[model samples]
Structures are given as structure tokens and as C-alpha cells.
Target chain A: MHEFAIARSLVDAAIDVARNAGVSRITRIRCRIGDLQQVDGDLLGDAFSAVCDGTVCEAADLCIERTHMAFDCERCGTTFLVGEWDWSCPGCGESGSHARGGDELELIGIDGELNDGNQSAPKCV
Target chain B: MMEIKVLRNVFEKNDRAAEQNRELFDRRHITCINLLGGAGSGKTAMLESIVPILSQSLRVGVLEGDLATTRDAERIAALNVPVVQLLTNGGCHLNATLVQHGLEALMQHELDLVIIENVGNPICPANFDLGEHLRMSVLSVTEGDDKPQKYPLLFKAVQAVLITKCDLLPFVDFDIERAKADIRRLNPTAAILRTSSQRGIGIEDVADWLRQIVNERQSLVAAP
Candidate 1:
């Protein structure tokens, strides 16, 4: 649902970066997705490929790095990464802690090749 | 060829449009609130309770965001107020660009208070800011008590939390104190309130808070 919309925007951003860099085609895109974002990686990949039809990023590979939710305890002033169902502070065994990071959806980098006179390779179908 | 390193936020474009929308609202001195929650979390019901009460003195309008159909918009129309429905078709959340477009449609009615009912989903809607002066989170008792723990971002972004469906609290095992504590653990500063649109419980309190926010926004705009 909304993952497809986000994937479309990411693909659009990758294309914009590639065009700005004077690249003819994009080879790979590196994205950082947080665990709390509720975005499906497979769905995003398929949606990206489907939306990039006839665009420069049709064959581009989407490299995603999944991030985890971390929290910092206010009482004990301890920071820890919450795994699975446990969000308690490991330092003081506190039940309540404020969340930090792990909700970001950002594009880190894009790798593309500039078209030169020698490298006239045909496009991949 | 030069290696270009552009560490850009993927939502940069939408954020820019949202900024523009904010500027437009500021120039007009409008008190805008973005209502966000999961599907069938009683967002429209909250609006149904508050809008008519506020319209008694203040000019109010609504901007509805939904996947399809104008059902919610039709309900708001029953009050005989100005409302515009922005259908996303299949989009998961309403982005800033789409909200800007909807604002243009709402402006034709010359509204004072614009309540944007965001597409229902705690996850996707939390990511996009719809260019409002205030963000409010809506949660119903039927959605489970652990919703605040699971969807922290929605509660974290909003200034207040509205817990709806208190009338069914007798039949269901929804711990009101636990829900408040869970929300406070995530957001210590959030204003919490319990409401039941069916039984008219806590509706007046919700209206009073909305009035306070609207008045505060207006004073801030009038400040030298």
C-alpha cells in the first residue's frame, strides 16, 4: 500500500541524483530503512522495479540496510537497542524508556556510470 | 568523472512543499490541526463532535483524506459546513504535495480552522507531515492497549492523544490508566484525554482543548 508510494518516491529521488550527476544509467541505490517504518523490502523492491519501467533505473539494484529501534532510559540514563518484545532498560532494569532512531527512511547514496564513447553496452531487458 | 556524494533525505521534496503550505497558512492566520490515527479509530467521530460545537462561534472547515469514496466527507456535510475530500485512490498516506493540493480546494470556502483527517494508518502517516500547526493522535479502545508501544512514532509526533470509545470500556478490558502510562512513557509531555463519541463522554473536554489551541495559535499570529 503506502510502501509502494514510498518506493516510487525513492526511485524518483535516485533518478534525480543520477541525472544531476550527468550519469546515463543507474546501477545501484543504497537506502537505509528502519525496522519501525513498516515497509516490506520485497514489496519495495518489486514496486521500485515496476515503477521504474522505461526509466534509467529499470535495472538498478536497490540495496537496503535495515535499522533497529534503540531507546535511552531517562531514569538511569542508559541507552540500549531493543530486540524483539523486550524494551526494558538493561542497565537499571527500568520498564520505561524513551525511543531514539530506528524510524528513518532515507537514501544514503546512488552509484551510476557515465556514458562514454567506448562503453556502448546495450540495455538489459 | 567526479564522484558525487549526496546524502539527501528521501522526503526532502515533500518537506519543502509542507514548508510552503505552512507559510501559506501562517500568512492567512489559520489554526490548522492534523488528525492522525489507524483506520476506524473514530477520527471522523471526533470531528463530528468538535466541529459543530466550534462552528457555533468560529469558522471551521475540514479536509478529508481517504483511500477512496466520499463517505466521511458526506458525513461531515451533514453539519452543513465546508469540507473537501481528497481521495488517494491507492496511496497509503497523504503526502505534503497532495495536502497542498487539498488546501487549495479548502481555501475556496475561506475557513478559519482546518482539520485535516489524514489517511488512517499509524505507521505511514507518521512519516509525512501534512503542514499543520498541530498534530493530534487518535486511538480507540478496540485497537488494543499495546498500540502505543507498537506505534510510538505516531504518538511521539503529536501534541495530544485522544482515546475514543470509552462507552465500550465496561464490556471490554481496556485499562485506561495503563494506556495513559504507556503513552506517557513514550511522550512525557503529551496531553491525554479519554472520549466516547457514542455516549458524549469527554466530548466537551476535547472541544475545550481544541479551543485553547486555536486561541493560542491566533495569539501567536497576532503577537508583535
Candidate 2:
């Protein structure tokens, strides 16, 4: 559903960056998605394939890195990885810890070849 | 090989649109509330009940989001207020871009409060922001009490939870206490209110709360 929209953005961003870097073809795209986004990796990959058709990123590969959710204990100032929705602080046994990460959906980097009016080696820009 | 680090959020466009919408609302001194709920969570019914009361003292406008119908807009237009229906075609959720367009149509009139009734789906709509001052989700007793746990993102993102269809609470097996407790656990700061638009219960309180928000914004706008 909305994965189509997300994939469209991802492809567009990759193309924009590749063109800005004077690269003709995007080899791969590295993305970091947090757990809180709740995006289905398989669905996003399918969507990317569908959206990449007829675009510069048609042959590009999408690499996704899932970030785990973590929480910061408000009472004890201890940060811990959330285990199965457990909000209790292991240090103080107190509930209601503030969420501290795992909601990111960012494009980390891109790997492509530079087309500087001549043949050149593949570059990760 | 060159490795260029972009470090850009995929939702950057949507987030930027939402920020622009917030700026527009602030500049106009308008309080916008994004009303979210399931298909039959009494979102339209609650609006039908509260709009009249809210229109009594404050200028009100509504942006109705539906997959493919103007029926909700027709209903709100009957109230004689500025109402715009946004057809998302088959989109599951309304994004900030759609809301930006809706606001352009709604702002033609001098409105103090604008309510954007998002397309009925708890999961997808929870991920998108429509640039509203407040986000309120409606849950009917018929939807069951476990919804808060099942749709944690929707429950956790809202500033208020409206338990609609309270008149049917006695007949249904929905555990109000458990639902409230779950909502509290997920969002301790969210205001939970029980409302029955059919029975005219808690309508005044909801209207009063909206009025207070509008008044507060107006004062801020009027201040130095």
C-alpha cells in the first residue's frame, strides 16, 4: 500500500544523489530503517523493483539495515534495548522509559560509478 | 569506488510538508486537529454532533478524507460550514501533501478551527503526519478494547483518545477499564474521554476543550 510511496521516494532520492555525483548508474543503495517504522522489508523491496523499472536505478540493489528499538530509563538514566515490548527498566524496575531510537528511516549512502565524460572505475559516493 | 553518505530520511519530503502546514496554521492563528479512527469508529458521527456546538462560538471547517466518495462532505455541508472532501482514490492514508491542498481549499474562509478526518484505517494513517495541532483517535466499544495494544502506533501517537459509542458499552463486551489502562500505559499524557454522540454525552466537554484550544491560540496570536 503505502510502501509504494516510500519506495518511490527511495528511488527518487537515489537517482537524485547519483545524478548530483555525476554517476550514470546506481549500483546499490544503503538504507537504515528503524523498528518503529514497521515497514515490511519484502514489500519495500518489491515496491522498489516495481518503481525502479525504466529509471536510472533499474539495476540498482537496495540494502536495508534494520535498527532495533531502544529505550532510556527516565528514573535511572540507563539505556537498554527493548525486549518484547518490555518497558520496565532492568536497573531500577521502574516503568515508563522514554523511547530513544529505532524510528529512523534514512538513506545512509549510495554506491555508483562516476561517468566523467569518460570510462571510470565504480565509486561509492 | 566512491562512497557518498547521504544520511537523508526517506520521509523527508512528507516531514517537510507537515512543517510547512504547521507554519501555515500558526500564521493564520487556526487550530487544526487531525481526527483518526477505524472505518466505523464513529468519526463522522462525533463530528456531526460536535460541529454544531463548535460552530456556535468558533468558525469551523472540515476536510473529509475518503477512498472514493463525497457522501461525508455532503453531510458536513448540510451543516452550512465550509467542508472539503479529499478523495484519495485507493490510497490507504492521506499524506501531508494532500492535507496541504485541503488546507488551501479550507482556508478560503476565515476559520478558527479545522478538523481533518483522516481516511479510516488505524495502521497506515498513524505513520503519516498531516500537520495538525492535535492528533485524536476515536475508538468505538464495538472495535474491542484490545485495539490499543494491537495498534500501538496509533494509540501512542495521539494526544487524545475518544472512546466513542459509549451508549453501547453496557451491551458490548468491551472492557473500558482495561482499554483506559492500556492507553495510559502507552501514552500517559493522552487525555482519554468517553463520548457517545448518539446519546449527546460528553459532547459539551469535547466542544469546550476545542474552544479552549482555539482561545489559547488566538491569545498567543494577539500577544506581542
Error of 2 at B108 (Å): 1.8
Q: When only chain A is evaluated, what TM-score does every model earn? A: 0.85, 0.86
Among residues 3 or more apart in sequence or in different chains, the pairs in candidate 2 whose N, CA or C atoms overlap within 3 Å are A123-B1, A123-B2, A124-B1, A124-B2, A124-B3, A125-B2, A125-B3, A125-B4
Clash count, predicted structure 1: 0
Please provide, for model 2 over B78-146, each residue's C-alpha lDDT reduced to its tens digit, 9 standing for 90 to 100. 999999999999999999999899888889999899999999997778778788989999999999998
In candidate 1, which residue pairs get closer than 3 Å at backbone N, Cα or C atoms, i.e. clash? Answer: none
Give the per-residue lDDT of model 1 (tens digit) for B182-211.
687667788898999988888889888988
Model 2 per-residue lDDT at B216: 87
Which tens-of-lDDT digit does each residue in A34-119 have in candidate 2?
A: 77677899999999999999987787888898897666777898888766544578899777665556667888888777784333
TM-score of each: 0.91, 0.88
User: RMSD in Å for candidate 2, one decimal?
Assistant: 3.0
